[model samples]
Target: MDTREKILKAAAEMLAEDMGAKLSVRAVAARAGVSTGSLRFHFPTQRALQDSLLARIYEHLLPGDPIRDPALPPRERLLNCLRQVLALIGTNEDARTAWGATYRTFIEPEPTEQLRAAYLRHEREAERRVEHWLTVLAEEGALPPGDHTRNLRFLLTILNGLSVERALPTSQSVFLAEAETLNAAVDFVLSAGPASPVESTQP
Candidate 1:
């Protein structure tokens, strides 16, 4: 394989082995059997490397992402994407285990710097994925023109709530409730009017 590809492969393996360790330029270079200078030439900064790595992970996490399917309605496309995120949390025992791990790592006790950084990295990745979905819809004129920051936050908040509910006991049909909630959230964002454009000062 090519030098750049080799470096990326090595980095992906390292990430799979440990989510938050062995990502430094020196470490990746050593793993890839390439010089640090070569790795630097391919990825100028750590952020650049991490961004590329995360993009690769996203692809692996969702191959042939449903968000890119043009045949699906915009709302449906977005709902499908959101559902994929929740699916990772699984259901019943799997969901409980995921929540337990989260509490131990982030909630019960104060998180250390390493733990905090790892959490932030994951949070940013999630934000990036949502932003990309909005951008795709906006490009197709399927989404209204607006500052999507609020919309992004709204969707994520809904998702977080839904994920929490997965581990809880509820009388209602969780699947039906989740579908209705996701549909309502998607409709609310999609039906909103465009943001007001800033007036230009030039005469």
Candidate 2:
């Protein structure tokens, strides 16, 4: 990767690991195998680096809207929607690792204004993503008519809890894989709503 990309990637990895507290120009430069001068050339300040990292995280987390194919069975479409939500946790070890880093970067407390701004930006992006899917489902007659904003908040709340649960030792102790957890969450949402009954086909 180019130097700027390398710096961003290194920063992202650090943030994923909850090393945001320790991030510094020098450390990022070392991690990227670039000179501090080079790092500064691309990102002259920590806020600049942080802004770039936040954008990258959003890009990774908020993948463009899922395909809402009308031809697919309702259950299939709902499962696809749920999987899209669960995808935020990632689908594999590498992805989960990257997600861990992102989670750390997102929730870890920081006093900097830039960090707070980044956090809010990420929050809005997350809400937009959830709102987009729910709206699509509603338009497709998959979701029952109701207050979408409230529904979005409710789902996001549960999703946030599930995300945190995945990071806990208790979840691993119970062998609760990410997919199973997500599937269960999705099932609950689909079954509780006016959405079609879930098919036996695995998500």
Q: Tell me the alpha-carbon RMSD of every candidate.
A: 4.4, 10.1
Superposed by TM-score, candidate 1 places the C-alpha of residue 183 at a distance from the truth, in angstroms, of 0.8
Clashes of 1: 0
Off by over 4 Å in 1: 1-6, 31-33, 112-114, 169-173, 193-203
**Candidate 1 lDDT, 1-203, residue by residue in tens:** 99988988999998766655638899999999999999999999988888998888777877778888878988889989999999888987788887877786567767778778877887888888888888888888988755778778888899889998998876675999899999999888788733555699999
Model 2 RMSD in Å is 10.1
By TM-score, who's the top model here?
1
Off by over 4 Å in 2: 1-67, 91-107, 144-146, 170-203
Candidate 2 lDDT tens digits, 77-193: 655666665555643464457556766676555558767765665566567767766767767676776656665666678676655555554423422564576567566655565
Ten residues in sequence with the least summed lDDT for candidate 2: 166-175
The count of backbone overlaps in candidate 2 is 3
